[model samples]
Target chain A: MERLKSILLAEDNHMDVELTLEALGRHNLANEVEVVNDGAEALEYLYRRGKFSSRPAGNPAVVLLDIKMPKVNGLEVLKEIKGDPNLKMMPVVVLTSSREESDLIRSYNLGVNAYVVKPLEFEEFVTAVSRLGVFWAIINEPPPGSSRGIA
Target chain B: MRMDSIRSILLAEDNQMDVELTLEALGQHIFANDVVVVGDGAEALDYLRRNGKYADRQEGNPAVVLLDLKMPKVDGLKVLKEIKGDVSLRTIPVVVLTSSREEKDLVKSYQLGVNAYVVKPVDFHDFVEAVSKLDVFWAIVNEPPPARVNAG
Candidate 1:
């Protein structure tokens, strides 16, 4: 079987995670996802610390990050990743419930690759994640982060 | 290579099915667009530079470009390097459209300043939906940055 890249999804909301997983499952994409609950944990996973110490060594093809969270928060995490030369090239798409113009401006200013406003409607959210997978996994290309391209 | 028009999307891919699907997906979207199909990297560059068969084009730069990583005659990475390195065309978004899941494809594309990078879904229905979303986002929702003037 041809390998599919794993997706690292960092979202604090359990329901949101469930729904996202369900939606991806409907389109047969759930098998490729790795879910993390909060910003602090997300960073640990990215940095390979704590429980993530023994986790996969390679970088996720893309990171689906939620904005608000306990501990680090999405913007802070984004800042750290973008600031790290080893991880700066990793494609980050801000998938959050935020609708504020300030968050949008901040995310873009922070050099976020993309910013997606999460929809409250279940169908809309599903469609968003599905398309997000389609574009991030299927269309957009990235310069190999520290992991380093085409097989 | 039609050189007379600068408003053309240079697509690089070896797959006929994906090419057909992309065209079909674009048709469903409301955005009016014109895409120039090239089977490989060499043709993509040729189209960009208005070389050989593309000598008479009028549009100086295409609005956007969609590239596939694995291709004969130069591959996507080399093509991306050339486009980004060229001061004249660096502002234009060169998106990657491929089935590759390797980290290299992702990181390298971003490092090159590619405007967007995406993986084509294997399923047909998913492909249509994905393309439609892209059309909505890049063509409709997301605003392209203003053009850059050459620094003297």
Candidate 2:
């Protein structure tokens, strides 16, 4: 049996988080999403340190990270992830409401896998994320289909 | 308005045979795009950066980047790093379309933050069809990041 791929989602806003989870519910793919409220927590989840120390270790197929956060922020988190020799290939899609040039600039500079502008319209946002779900989870092949964990 | 923005695709590949096959497959698409090819990774970077030789390139960004691995000089991995590292170039949605699926390469490319990793079909005909389908899907549907003038 195939294991369900994990999705690392780093979002600070509760409302947006709920809405995104709901949107993902519409998809047929039941990806196990590890939700982190901020960039710091997101990093922790990826590295599996702190509370995540006890959790299983395997990289997510893709990461959906938001730009605005209290601690490290998306760009900083992106740099840490991309710069890491072991974790760099994990696909990270920037799903954020920030249209700020600085945010975009920094994210690209840090090598975010994809940068998606969260649509102001709920429907548009839903559609965009749905495509993301299909493409990343269903269509795109992960790193060689190996059963090896992130470690 | 957004859909109209994607007018062309610039495929940076070093091999001439690959160049021929990719162009032939692109012919299957409904959308008409100028699929420009640069022979090597260095040339590819120059075209994208508008540096040295590619000084007079077009105005807009390609809808997507279809990158090949294991090229001479700069190589796909490095080019991918350069594109994703550059503030202006990162959002371009690079799909690593290559032959080598070494676990290290796969892990490294995704870690480097490639949008998609598609192993090219080894057979010539299969390769053409695969590349063609990639063009079709990205050209018609994928919403590429907008033109940003500031990325270096």
Candidate 3:
């Protein structure tokens, strides 16, 4: 059987992170999520560097990226990912609070797989994340050579 | 409201049966009238580019393009490459909906910047469910590039 791929979530807000985890957990999706606080850590996780150097060898099924962060912002991380040959194909979804046209245009221009604006209401947010999780994690097939989780 | 103001879905598939099934599945959430079905990749491109028979069509691009890998004439990959390569059309989301589970196709599609890839399920019910989920995510949840981005 094919191993389930893990999901790398790069988000800065603690409250949103907790809410997202809770939403994924409600759908039994929490086990696969690996969280990072900022863009630099996200790069580390993806490249398996720094504290994440010994963690895993393969890429996550999908990256749920938040636009605003303390260190490297999500757009910078997206630019780096899409620019690299090895990491370019890994699916990255922009799960952000910004509905600004410029951000939407830029993300797509940078080759983001999808861009979803975070819902304002708690219930709507949960539903959106749950649907997003189910679609990316279970329904959509990740590209070839994506992480199949640790054996 | 202008016709182009209503963002429709463009489906490029050669298989008539699959087209019917997809339309049926999408009909649950999206209006059947909102889906513009093309029999092959050439027509798909024509519709998108507003060329040949589609010269007089609406100006705006579709919200999402559901592409099937195997098609007559240009083929899905070529269509994807054309769309992604062209600055005017690159922002429009393109999802590959095909029966092919070939690794090379998957790799190539992603390399060309496909938004998502879904393998069509053999089971009828599963196919409908998958299509419904896909529709909900792309059409409702996903924020597509603004129509103004394609003004060029």
Candidate 4:
């Protein structure tokens, strides 16, 4: 049986994480999300190293990355992913509160698949995240070799 | 003028039926009327670069480009390469909306820096739903790059 691919969400703020998960939960996709607090843990999860060792062998369907995080930041993580050929094809979307043009420009320049600014209003934010989840996790076909199911 | 407010979608599709279906699907959204459809990859590039027949068209890039793989001239992959390689156009989002589910096509598109890859659903209802969802995400949810005035 083919297992649904998972979405990796790298966010530091507990409130944002809960909100995002809640938004995705509205689409029955909350279970598909794997949360990581910072960029370092995100990398570890992707690389299947450190604490994430022996977790899985394939890349996640998509990564919902936050720009500002403790330890390694989102841009650095994006650079690392896009620069590395094996992981480059894996889709990464920047989900941040930053509406700064520089951040938008840099994310696209770094080869991010998409950039979505978290809406300031509560309802708008939920709608945005839900739409984003549905698009990336369901509508978009992830790259080859992405995680299919549990071993 | 604030170009970001202009949420135009460029569709490069050779198939007339597919084009109609895409337009129809996109019609469900407010930005539906903003779509600019081109029949082939050459026209796609022309529309993007503001060359040939499109020389006097516009100065800003579309919010996103929905590209079809097979075409009479240039083809979608070539068009994607040109867009991603050019500094001024690289930031513009490009999504491959093709019928082909071949692994090579998927790999090639991602390698060429396509923002997303979506397979055209076979069923009519599914196709419409997919496109509508895609439209909402790219046009409304996602933040497009700051508009750059193309210098000719």
Off by over 4 Å in 2: A1-5, A141-151, B1-4, B13-34, B38-46, B49-55, B59-63, B70-93, B107-115, B121-152
CAPRI tier of model 3: medium
Clashing pairs in 4: none
Per-residue lDDT of A1-151 in model 4, one digit per residue for the tens? 4333488999999999999999999888888888999999999988888987777577888999999999999999999999998999999999998877778888888889999999888899999999998998889988987853121
lDDT of 4 at A132: 92
DockQ each: 0.18, 0.25, 0.59, 0.63
Q: In angstroms, how far off is A90's CA in candidate 1? A: 1.8
Query: What's the TM for model 1?
Result: 0.62
Q: Give a tens-digit lDDT track for model 3, residues B14-77.
A: 9999999999889897444389999999999999999999999878788899999999998999
**For residues B28-101, could you state the per-residue lDDT of candidate 4 as single tens digits?**
98664499999999999999989999999878888899999988888999999999889889889999999998
Docking model 1 quality class: incorrect
lDDT of 2 by residue, A60-128 (tens): 877888888989988888889888976776777888887776676567666666667787887876766
lDDT of each: 0.72, 0.73, 0.88, 0.89
lDDT of 2 by residue, B82-147 (tens): 987877777787888777868898878876778788777789887876676566546653445566
Better model by DockQ, 2 or 4? 4
For model 3 the local lDDT of residue A137 reads 81
Clashes of each: 36, 8, 0, 0
Clashes of 2: 8
How high is the lDDT of residue A117 in model 4? 90
